[model samples]
Target: MRPPDNRRRRFEELYQANHDPVLGYVVRRTANGHDAADILAETFMTAWRRLDDVPAGEKARPWLFGVARRALANHHRGERRHTALTARLASELSAIQRQPREESADMDALAKAFEDLSDGYREVLSLADWEGMSIAEIAVVLGCSANAVRIRLHRARRRLARALSVDPPGRAARARVPEGDSA
Candidate 1:
């Protein structure tokens, strides 16, 4: 294995090689150069910290893109959080009906069903389905054994299916998802 110094040099080389492309990637996705620059700096900093996790040679670009993608997602989530806070403050300051939009009844039911899931089930499902993370990646993120992730994912799906009435309640109860396995 190479020395840590050697690894640092390699990471520096990667930064030199990919910085422009990474910046371009962020710039195209972001609204302004300032946000792009922030994302660019964050992406490289993450790469620097996780140098060993970065794939070698041809795969590095895509890996860096993935990192940037996560950063962008986090950025958007923060924006949404701020927006939600403002909305909440506005709601507190006034009297509004806050009527639900004209969503389909089925959509409402699905949303309720998803909301009814336990936090653990919801998280695993979101990470797997919404975030498009692989089982191994989910395992890494959740800090659990891969088999445990698979088991929880399986259980979460079954519970969600039951909630949505896609799976029979009898089976959902009978299978009995182990409470011990949580992300």
Candidate 2:
């Protein structure tokens, strides 16, 4: 029972115990087997590095799942950025194009508000609302306490609501112009 000897055996046991389930989790969510394998490998790599951090018992599975969830998110984010870059390049290269459709003013305002949110607030909201993850699940992914996740979620929702309720900048400025003084 030394640093790595103890750690290695424990990790081997963990990997043997959970590898199939972890693989299945990733494979179910990912589009391709290759990507699933990659994520699975990365997940185990993280577990290897943080072997001491894995929970002592049943919580280990959920903890690994959380790590896999983050790896998947990172993969998707990278894919989306790549796709956006490709689309932008295509749009620039195209000589002829129809005028872009106008989004609703409300949608424009909402998008601006979302963009203005801090990364932590946006991530918390996305995990809670967009991903439909429970508070416990989010806490696992974020490596925080359930109470912390709950508090963060509450604050994020309040911030989003406040952001959504704010008037568009132009309208707010117009409202500030004292009646006749249209400066």
Candidate 3:
């Protein structure tokens, strides 16, 4: 058997290798950086606890993603409230300062479009567009048939396109509109 220190070192190696992908997975599913961090921490915690169950080699990414999905679900369950995932994502994009102003504006508009999407549409878009998961993989993540994921993705894309086409509020309009106009 490997020494305890050797096993611990191996686990750290596996974790470090998978960290970025796992973080991306959490960020795509959650609304904000805070939630993403929470989910990521929970995912790694699960991994540490179930290290023996994680398969060796290339299959690790999928296994870790599965853990992330469970952690997100648990978060939602415990909170008993669901924030719009796209809204959270929008806030995250706004927090990134390195991008040019024009690029940030575009991202803000895209985030609004995403937020306007129906929950089904947002979920499909998050899985496919944000997470870069294949339709088959999204189907697995969502527990739906592949055809279902495809149909939802198609509709969601169309809706997002429509949402993006709408003009954003001007400064005057933003100031004048009642607080509940979009809400």
Candidate 4:
């Protein structure tokens, strides 16, 4: 049973005789070629390790088929576990992505409404609100006096606030109140 040269010779004979049948058995059970290849390797590895357990003659092929079947089952179980983990991670990722976006929907509406404003109003409001520019800086950019920039900024803000007032909150801010309905 512990004779090294004899053991190797027997395993080699068994492998030569049964490699194709065992591979075909595993390949038919698994979807992926790689999985089939791996299961085949594992089956042969098991046969080599348990050489004494392997039967002689025609019985040896059935014994190898049984080993391949079990290897294929183990491979399928591992695939199921991997698939379940990916799905759980995707669910968690989508939940995280949605939370911030839900909070920003109102901002999306505000930006949409802002787009409909006259260029002057948009410029003045963007400078004051988004760019964090001072009246002096805005006047220089607009080529207007500081007092004029102040007046334009104030008017732009009032107009924006009035525009927003008509918009139902938590809806697309892009919707416009008809000029007739601006009351």
> Better model by lDDT, 3 or 4?
4
Taking all chains together, each candidate's TM-score versus the true structure is 0.47, 0.49, 0.42, 0.52
Supply the global lDDT for candidate 1: 0.86
The residue pairs that clash in candidate 4, if any, are none
lDDT of 2 by residue, 1-183 (tens): 356687889999999999999999999989899999999999999999998899988999999999999999999998899999999879964622333434455566777888899999899889988789999999999999999998888777777778888553344556466777866
**Superposed model 1: Cα runs more than 4 Å off:** 1-3, 94-183
**What would the per-residue lDDT of candidate 4 be over residues 85-167, giving only the tens digit for each residue?**
99998998686567787666766667777887899999998898778999999999999999999888777777676676753
lDDT of each: 0.86, 0.86, 0.84, 0.86
Better TM-score candidate (2, 3)? 2
lDDT tens digits by residue: candidate 3, 50-145: 888988999988999999999999987766544566667678756776788998898899888898888888989998877999999999999999
Worst 10 residues of 4 by lDDT: 167-176
Q: Identify the candidate with maximal TM-score.
A: 4
Tens-digit per-residue lDDT, 111-168, candidate 1: 7988999999899999999889999999999999999999999888888887877873
* Runs in model 3 lying further than 4 Å from the true structure: 1-3, 81-183
